[model samples]
Target: MKDHETLGERLAEQGISRRAFLKFCTALASLMALPPERAAAMANALARSQRPSVIWLSFQECTGCTESLTRSYTPTLESLIFDMISLDYHHTLQAASGFAAEKSREDAMKNFYGKYLLVVDGSIPINGGGVYSTIAGRTNLDLLQETAKGAAAIIAVGTCSSFGGIPNARPNPTGAVAVSDIVRDKPIVNISGCPPIPAVITGVLAHYLTFGTLPDLDDLNRPRSYYGTTIHDRCYRRPFYDQGKFAKTFDDEGARNGWCLFELGCKGPTTHNACATTKWNGGTSFPIESGHGCLGCSEPHFWDAGGFYTPLSAPVVNIEAATLGAAIAGAGVAVAMSSLDRNKIRRAQQAHEKLTVKEL
Candidate 1:
């Protein structure tokens, strides 16, 4: 590996203008929940420190994670490479294959060992001596263990690597297991999603490279900033859910009117992810924004959890009562005007209120 370039020189070589680079720094500071002044400090730290090397390992996965990452071409390729961490070896990205490709990975580990990041996208099948997935005539189990030995910190990239994924489904033939199951000693951070949001993946890596440590993680080892809040908390259709206006069917009036998708098997309330907040495809929209309910792909065991069209949970508390109580107390004039000659509306309101009271 060449000598590490200072941030200023690196950014210059990467062709990122000073102003744009600073804006990137500002975004990073905001994402990290740090103060605006922290941007300059982060810039200083980044300028002095070397660009961290990253080795991406793919095992029993569908390449969805890589697809999500490559779709990160928002502003430009320079943005992805210069701002986020550097990718030293990615079998998918690297042109080399066979012994040459394996040598490149070995070289990266040797050159940046104890400092490079190890990102595994799929699970390791230990059944039958790991013959399920092999590279360069070696099983994934052997390759992963060998790579993890030299990594400074390990990041299980997708649900596959984080939680055994679909390969560990019922009547398992491969006996797949997550990286955490095998490498129990290292600092492993799991970004558990079918294919986690691109921003979140890069955000975590950026946080580690810039801040020199992993961000505060939840009990499930997800970064708190990204996964701390539930999708329901930041949902744009929250008003509909609170108002008890749900889409009963996919093509119903409620769905057409952009109402909530809770009744139709939305897992938003229980799902912890940054999809609703950071968004996808350059902050344009997410699944919920597209009029579809969340599948809870980010949570563990989400695959076998339940159908996407099933209610997340039975309402233990009366949501309608609470919403109506606020409305009747505050919007008295509107309620009074609309209360008359609306028997169906009034009855529905009362039924919800009664349910709420019953719960209480």
Candidate 2:
């Protein structure tokens, strides 16, 4: 593959039409929350831009992130966008091994220095001189530092690489730490999820390619477009929550009726992610839609956030008092609105009577 060829040229060689490419760009723009008018701009930028060099590093992870990305539907636009990038090095996906693989990585680093993108998917173990994980006789710590030195930016692709994940959970024996905990010099974007949504990964990349800058990030360094709202706020069962109808157990009548799962230990109220919208497996359903409560996998230290089946209000000592306070507040708002509506109706009736007398 010629490095000089633009992405559009490569897609053309693959028999993809210009119209298809533009459509893909439009979908990406919508996914990234970009304006409809920006689709043409995105298409132009992507068409003219050179394929960026990406070095994907995996550490203490289960490869679930990779699985999620590769299995993102079949021949989907997001997957195509991912393929457009020049992925120079990835341990699991690359065919080369041993010294040959290491050489490939070194060559890419030297050739694309200051232009490559470093994508990391797991936590780096800091214990015992970082002996827990190694590649080509070098620890993940050494490789990340060495690789990030010349890259334009770093994308922490999973909860592990973003927040230390399960490896860094309570009683963490490996002393795992996220990439941000170590590499403070480069711009880092966290796509935090147990295994982040595939479209989200592609959307962030598309944004960077189009705008030549990283997307706006939240306090946790995650993209705000996707993680801006909590799962509870967007959940289909929200009306049930407001009506105070909850499923006490998984097999109860309320559960069958699709009521709120808060009492059943759903972390949706506190978890921020795009699962409820983008969903998984070709937009079929998320965990919550599949009759399971959210585990808050996208949040940092979720594994240590108490039981997955425990409600947020369970651990709080003032559960009754807090519930009462919330109910009273809601009631007060409802009453105020009702009073305003009544006053408007009474004034309208009085105006009609005055108009009748004036007419007479």
Candidate 3:
């Protein structure tokens, strides 16, 4: 319903109404943690400037990353994907295939060389000389490396691509490795999670589109604006934990009262992510808020740190038969105390004992 132009100019020409554009700006402002005025400026910038080109690469991973993007219903990511920017390559979403798909990627890479955003959603397995995955007869590793050669910035979309997800877990028979492992020279912004929140994914993209750079990131390469604080810090049950009130079991009265889940092995204290705040399905609710403990899904090595049912710090339980002889070291001292108590029942003995002790 609007004429085409640079993203900046488009915002300027937003003939629909200020209500819609202002709403979009408000979303951007909240995500960026910027003031309203700043958000307005960001909106103007996006509406006036040319939309950036994004090339999404799907490698050895499930389509969960794409699924997350599709779940972004507000503003309808379909609108953003189709109207906001030029999505030149996406194997799952694109209608073209075979040589047409490969050429589409190649053409876009050449046309927008060194200026397009590269989004990857899976890790590259370097086993057997990186031949595990091949697209268009080229290995995913080779394709990633080659594509990175001219990309402006890289976005590692899912946990699989960001931190090797489950593929790179212990033993790692496939020898899976993240994008950062192979594409070391470029600037990478990692959005790590099995399926990262839709808002988070779009927020980062919108921030880059508005500001022309990556969003502020934490040490783990996740956007600090979203993942800076641990889930426990913002959790509703935090007060209960501080008060030492806890839920002993899943279906107990404590749970009914929405008491602290710490005793139930909540990992929110150590795990960092925006689940508590930016919840899935457009800020509905997170797992912990909905009668479930946090699984610490966003953290690296989440699958191996411990089990979902295991306590965050379970007490040591050693029940060998060898400790039976170690519990009776003070029997003689107990008998001596009993003898002294019996002697104290005699008044003359009590007084005499006190006098003798004093003289000694």
Clashing residue pairs, backbone N/CA/C < 3 A, model 1? 265-309, 265-310
Where does candidate 1 stray beyond 4 Å?
1-3, 14-16, 73-77, 82-84, 314-360
User: Over all chains combined, what TM-score does candidate 1 have?
Assistant: 0.84
- Residue-wise C-alpha lDDT for candidate 1, range 21-117, written one tens digit per residue: 6777787776666788888777767666677778899999999998888776332345556544567678888778788888878998998889888
Instruction: Write model 2 residue lDDT over 8-98, tens digit each, in one string.
Output: 7887777888788778877788789788888888888988878788889999999999888886653364445344677778898888898
Q: Give the TM-score ranking, best first.
A: 2, 1, 3
| TM-scores of the candidates in the order shown | 0.84, 0.85, 0.82
Query: Against the true structure, what is every candidate's RMSD?
Result: 9.7, 13.7, 18.2
Per-model CA lDDT versus the true structure: 0.76, 0.80, 0.75
Q: How many backbone clashes does candidate 2 have?
A: 0
| Maximum-lDDT candidate | 2
lDDT of 1: 0.76
Q: Name the top TM-score candidate.
A: 2
Model 3 lDDT tens row, 90-131: 989999999999998898899889988899998899998778
